[model samples]
Target: MVNEPSNSANGGARRPWITTVAILLVVLLAVGAYLKLRPRRIRISVVQPALQAVSSSITTNGKIEPIHSFEAHAPLAVTVKKVLIKEGDRVKAGQLLLVLDDSRARSDLALARTRLKTAQAGYSALLAGGSQQQLLVRQADRQKAITDRDAAQRQLSSLERLQQRGAASPDEVAAARDRFSRAQADLAQLDSQVRYSPQDLARSKAEIADAEANIAVAQETIRNSNIRAPFDGTVYYLPARLGAFVNAGELLLQEADLSQMQVRAFVDEPELGRLAVGETTKITWDALPGRTWQGTVTTVPSTVVNRGSRVVGEVLCKFDNSDRLLLPNLNVSVTIIANSKDNALTVPREAVREDAGHSFLYVLQGNRLHRREIKLGISNLTRVEILSGISQNDIIAVHSFSPAPFSDGVEVKIVENPS
Candidate 1:
């Protein structure tokens, strides 16, 4: 009977330990079963893999700029008094866009008109005979000169004959000789007086013409006070306000033909050979979503490379502006089709991944995912051209719920999409 009750208590303590171990073993088995039944996460997209004619195009970033942009400036200095057009108003060629105070111009024009009139009058006078009094005076002087010359010649002959016969003294002969010489000189001077003095007449005429020209120039300057549109365009900007004083060549407005819109895009050096005049282009704008505008390469920039960095040159594309909505300075993006090939295999762009300067994609066959190395060609934002390593029907996983390291023989299940 020794210590039998204490032995029962020790037995009970051992029983508790055995029960705790059994519960822990059951919990472990339950956890392992839950993990085995858990679902795997996978992302799937509805993809269409096909072979069709695909054009290899180059996409570049660029901005929309007007083909005809110009700054309207005043030809002469004047105070602006009234503006006819606002910032966004369409105007025709020769339409008045603004008007200056023009008092100065008017005065100038009046002066110019006077000059023109004077020039015309002077020109008229030149066409008609010179002054009658002047003509008469010339005729009289010419006649007098002829008479004096005749009398001098007669006197000289008489003196010579008298000296030869010794009827006239030597002194008398010399005196007659002097008188004849003096008469000849007077006749020559009279002859000169009869003709017009070229210098004097020319000076007077030139003075009159100059005065007339000044007045005419003033008139033309006044006419220019009314600033007119050079072409049919919209007044895009007007810097001068009414009653504002402006100087010659000051900015009046910036006008551009909204109807004449174009796209200018730059390319990298390596792609220089791909662009040429008459090549087709596809234009897209963030402002106009989902719509692609057709354009043509109208001008290939002559600048082949950057002078400093030797980068590629810019190319210009012209599209018909029929909609009349395209404006200057609107941003745009362009795609240049370098080549086109029929039945080229292409896949979604997101399917490709980069590794060590090579492109690759995960191909799904049955339940296995295989990493397929690929060579790429041209690519748009939505699709990429597949040059090699993938067939038309091969299923390429575009997205995954979790990206983890996978062995070669790893199996994956594609998640179903909601109907």
Candidate 2:
């Protein structure tokens, strides 16, 4: 009777309710503990100022170029009969690089020589006193003509006097007048012969000189058919072979003076001011790794090249680390040291961010990130030169954790071992 009374006194209904309430409380507490204690995995990189060394430099893309590269082309139209060199063959100045058929050139030269010889003979004859036989014939003809004209003049004068005095018949006077007119024409023609003699000689000489000039030009064309190297260089590419036809100024071979060479590199505008002539540079070619060649800035182009980036200019660096192993047109990487200052305040590149053209750093203060605007100078790829807004001893945040539980006024318990 007592047990039955106890079951009815506090029924199973109340027991179930109490048990459910306790279970709910335990679940809530466990959830709160999990949220507080669970670690947050984050990706981060550390920040540190890089120390300067002898090899400390700023790297940029570069290319290997020849210092004395030149293209050999045919000087005149000709057919290639033979090529003496192949690509990668060493050549010397004035060495025969190739030979053209030159049959046409030879024919041209022969024709020109024949014309020149004829001109020379004529010129020689002109230089030699006039031919004796021709001179004698002209002189004799002139003298005889003059004699006949004088006789005719005398007869005409007589005829005129007779006509005036009426002592001669009309028919006789007319005959004498006709003879005088014919003689006068002959005398005038004779005088013209003497006047033109020197002019004829001068005309002949000019013709001879013109023919001689043509001959000289033809000879030059023939000589040009035998292609020769203009400078001591290596044959980088030879496009012509025996029996290949070539035209005037057509590319035959490409040669480069390997003894002296340079690397042509484009510098971005942001880094141009840092480059200077005589500044040493380190170069690494993609073809050759683990081997760095030394070079110096020899020249800087004055004009800005319009590439994707507003290229400040092109730089020509003289490579002193040339070996037979190095060839032309090889891609290279160049490193230049803009400047360095000992004990300078610097920070990780990620620590800085741009906002409206102003740079700022996220600094950690009492487990909270603080935004501090900074003045920037030069920067390499990894570190930025800090002009102001930061001290050497200040620890700056390389990354950020924002819009989470922490705010401007929120209290943050920085995980001692932040994952």
Candidate 3:
């Protein structure tokens, strides 16, 4: 009887332990089923569109140049004799800048003058029949011929009268007549030699014209040897030194009126369409840091060219450089304000997505993402101007933390509100 009571006590203790274990198992199974069937929510960051001022600009590298500049080059191969002005000297119009060794030029001018004088003398001789010596010789020859002809004519007349009276033979009279005819022919030839033909006069005139042209050329060369400044400017470059020899067309000096300056900005070909005339430009140079100059775009590129490995267009800009601090051939940084607007609707560039030539944004509606097509306007590096399709009050999803792609009706968990 004692052993049966102990067995019943142990069975009662084991039954309570089994019921507690069954209840724990049922609770765990219900929790797992609930967790597996629950909906998933992707974690995302959201922002609302804002209204602010935005500007679209293009930053590029540019080169500074003078608006009104002059470069002097050697007119011919010559030695630099005198350098009157040094580099960085301010000069006036018609000022003598340098002098070249003009010995050869002067010699050439003298030779040309002598040739002109000779040509003039020859032309004068042609107009006046012949030279003085030739005229005198011809005159003497003509007088001798006239005297011979008169004597011969008298002889022929006497011979004819004598022949009629039988004092002179017929053969003698014929010989006297032949002598008179020969004298007349000799006189005619001498007169022809003293007179100039029309062709001769024309040819003489042509020679004079040629000589005059040579004189003009020689005079011009002499003037060029004396280098002079054609306009008022500053001499920024001087390559001609005293006694240095230079060849034709070699650069001697460069000058400019540093009151105005021009900049040629090289812009990438893709951003060329955004450039326009009259746009505001800001310039900065590494040599003069912290100083910025304002300018205007005077012209846009007409063609595209290759710059290094990039295709770019050259944009021209003009600015007032009255202080003369900016110089020519300086490389500078250029920023052109292509477009600007006040109080325009803007959103972070990350919020917008493009697909198949269409731009859209994912709007957060009641914790779900909705794809809405939006129109975009001017954009910069960080933000873009929203032209249409979403109001500033609507919350938009920039990106999701999960790997799942965002689609319409996708539930989202707001991880952080950036805006």
Candidate 4:
């Protein structure tokens, strides 16, 4: 009994040691696992949401064109005889710019005049009673007819007297009366031929008028041989060369009043909907580096077209070019301000992301990151407007270079924090 009590006491002591050792082992294991499983720090760049003005704009390529321009063309085929102005010469309205050889035009005018004169002469003769020779001939014919008729009447009377005296037959008296009647009819026919009928007079007058119209056209052509400036402008282009034969309606020169210029902005089709008339625009030219010009959207494109490799809509913009430094047909760049908001929460566009068609971003909370779904209002190429999710002071990941990339509950270290 004594030995059993001693053994029980010893066993109880031993049980306490075993329990304490097992607890220590469990603690050590737990500590090792925790050290192994702890999240690693990732190097990344972060930025906080800011409160500033945000704008939604469209930037695209454009070309400069003259809003006020004119192209001169030859009106007739003629050899250029003189070129009074050179390319890039300043000219005024009604100034003589060129002259064409008028030999052909003059010959044409002479022929037209001759035809007109001849037609008028014939027309005038037809208008007068008749030619003197024709009148004299007609009068002579009438007198002869009168004489013949009188002689016939006298013969008829003698015949009739003879008949009455029983020395002529009744048939002879009838023949004498018929001869007198025939002589009177011939005189009447000759008189009718001497006068002009209304139809004949109308035909002659129309011929004369048609000839005169031709003369007028020829005269106008001769006048047009001299090319004159229709407006005050700079002759930027002059294709008129001395002794060069040019056809009618051929381009002679081009001019424009360079007081103002236009820029044709070609916005991508996807970005075209944001364009509106009267919108403020900024323009730049590659040739003139570090310079910008201001303008307004004067015209919005009604349709889209394919230009080069892009599908774009051409928007017209007008600007003040009073200095005349900007030439026509120069390529330029255009930036159109579509929408803007002031005192709004804004963030870098690079920080904002999309998840399943929903706007999202990785926001830093303490040492860990949390995926946040956000709502946006307006955005430009560089910055975006954050509407609902992020606060002004919240830090969001802009870029990451660590092997362990961004994810929920992942620890991160900010290599750069640009507030």
The CA lDDT of each predicted structure is: 0.75, 0.73, 0.90, 0.86
Encode model 3's per-residue lDDT on 1-419: one tens digit a residue: 87999999999999989999999999999999999777678889888999999999999999999888888888789999999999889999999999888888788888888988998999898777689997788778789999998998999999999999999987899899999999889878876773788889888888888888888887887898888888898999998899999998999999998888999999999999899999999999898899999999999999999999999999999998888888899899999999999899999999999999999999998989999999999899999999999998999998788878788898999886534
Q: On residues 1-419, what C-alpha lDDT tens digit does candidate 2 reach at each position? A: 76898888688669889999999999999999999877543323335444442223556777778888878678676788788888998888899888877777678778877877877766665555356676687779889988998898898889889889998888988888888888888878876654336777788888777777877777777687777888888998888878877788899888988766788877887767677788887788766779888878899768778767555578889976347566777777888765656655677677788879988876556555567889976666766678788776665656534334222332334433445
User: Per lDDT, what order, best first?
Assistant: 3, 4, 1, 2
Candidate 3 TM-score over all chains jointly = 0.76
TM-score of model 1 vs. true structure: 0.60
Q: What is the C-alpha lDDT profile of model 1 across 185-224, one tens digit per residue? A: 8777765542345665686578677776676666666666
TM-score of each: 0.60, 0.63, 0.76, 0.69
Off by over 4 Å in 3: 1-26, 29-33, 40-43, 135-210, 401-405, 411-419
* Candidate order by decreasing TM-score: 3, 4, 2, 1
> Candidate 4: lDDT of 245?
93
Highest-scoring model, lDDT:
3
How far residue 163's Cα lies from its native spot in candidate 3, in Å, is 18
Q: Against the true structure, candidate 4 has what lDDT?
A: 0.86
Structure candidate 4, residue pairs in collision: none
